[model samples]
Target: MSDSGLPDGFADLDPFVADWALPTRAQRYEARLSKPYDDLVSFYDAVAPRAEEAIAYLNGLDINDLPDDAEKLLQLLYSMILVSYAVNVFKQNRIPDSGAAFFDMVAEPAV
Candidate 1:
């Protein structure tokens, strides 16, 4: 693992696009997984901050005019949103009505 807590290939990723490199929690928990469990946890911790930055950037883009590359990233951000829901709402018992939100917020077209 590198100083960022992520393994080598992951530490240098563009923070906004790092989601493509992160393994979902489900993957880490898979029965047949080969990687060390500790490595998975470390990677998750390292990627969490980058994922937040990515989500924020994606939230500011207009969905209709998004670039092709960004479209994939947008989908990845949505997956992160689902993970947020699981952690905050389900595991932490947070009320959806109180703080629920989505990352994608398309800007209004100029008049």
Candidate 2:
């Protein structure tokens, strides 16, 4: 097990530890990338198609099905980690909300 660089209270985020420790820009430029990082990138690419499937699965859930504690996972999947990778790395700006209340908490979108 690696030191996650996170505090103890945020245990639910442990699953994301491997993805989070990916090489920085300098490291990638220097070709000091680890095999695990490359594997993770490949894994995410392989699973890219499943994002929509996951979204559809989420849509299938009823309000009652989601326990109140799901907020942490929601934020982890949305605001914290994913947007950076989607927008910056994958070059996608528009996030598909699929007529859901996706941007409710966000401010106005810039033109």
Candidate 3:
């Protein structure tokens, strides 16, 4: 594994791990809102192409007990989901015309 803790095949994503591999929905959401649209686009463009491959790689593992590197990769994927909305629909960091609007997730599936 690389110093970023991502698996070998995903080393290219290491540069994004610190900022994008957020461990929770709230964190990812905050990150999405904090970054500029271009940043989101950069992340989306880099990771979207490898998404399928990442999913397939992760599918063989036990979701509840992913290894450290794998867990980071999973978090990165989660962030990608958040970025998709900005890149594909909203075209901005936050939701359009939804100022100061947010919700707390009372429950979320374990990663």
Candidate 4:
């Protein structure tokens, strides 16, 4: 019901939609690198707790026919997954000691 189109109870995540609801793996990866460590942590903190609830909500829907709002939510979840590594493991935006490293995703699954 929010302007971001995310389902109810997820409006708290509205502030992140423009940045985190990226539509592609490559974009999401780049987003992870572009954000500061603190920003990444903030995103993780907000989404981590709701991840399970989001999954369960999505599970009942038909993947082939998700609504626009649902799709955005899914994208946010994907971004969360990408951010988790930075927040939970790397503890930085980019991989430690791997300066300027990048992954060229030649192919990605159809959305």
Candidate 1, 17-74: lDDT as tens digits = 4333333434312311343434334434444666766566656778668654445454
Q: Write the per-residue lDDT of candidate 4 for residues 1-111, one digit (tens) a residue.
A: 688899887999999999999889999998988878899999999999999999999998999999989999999999999899999999888889887766788997876
For each candidate, what TM-score against the reference? 0.35, 0.31, 0.95, 0.93
TM-score quality measure for candidate 4: 0.93
Which residue pairs come into collision in candidate 3? none
lDDT to native, each model: 0.43, 0.39, 0.90, 0.91
Model 1 TM-score, all chains together: 0.35
C-alpha RMSD in Å of predicted model 1 compared with the true structure: 10.8
Instruction: Summarize candidate 2's per-residue lDDT along 65-111 as a digit string, tens digits.
Output: 65333332332334323334543464443334444433332332221
lDDT of 3 by residue, 1-111 (tens): 889999889988998999999878988988998888899999999999999999999998999889999999989999999899999999899889987877889776665
- Model 2 root mean square deviation, Cα atoms: 12.5
Can you tell me which runs of candidate 4 are displaced by over 4 Å?
Answer: none
Sorted by lDDT (best first), the order is 4, 3, 1, 2
The candidate scoring highest on TM-score is 3
How does residue 5 of candidate 3 score in lDDT? 98
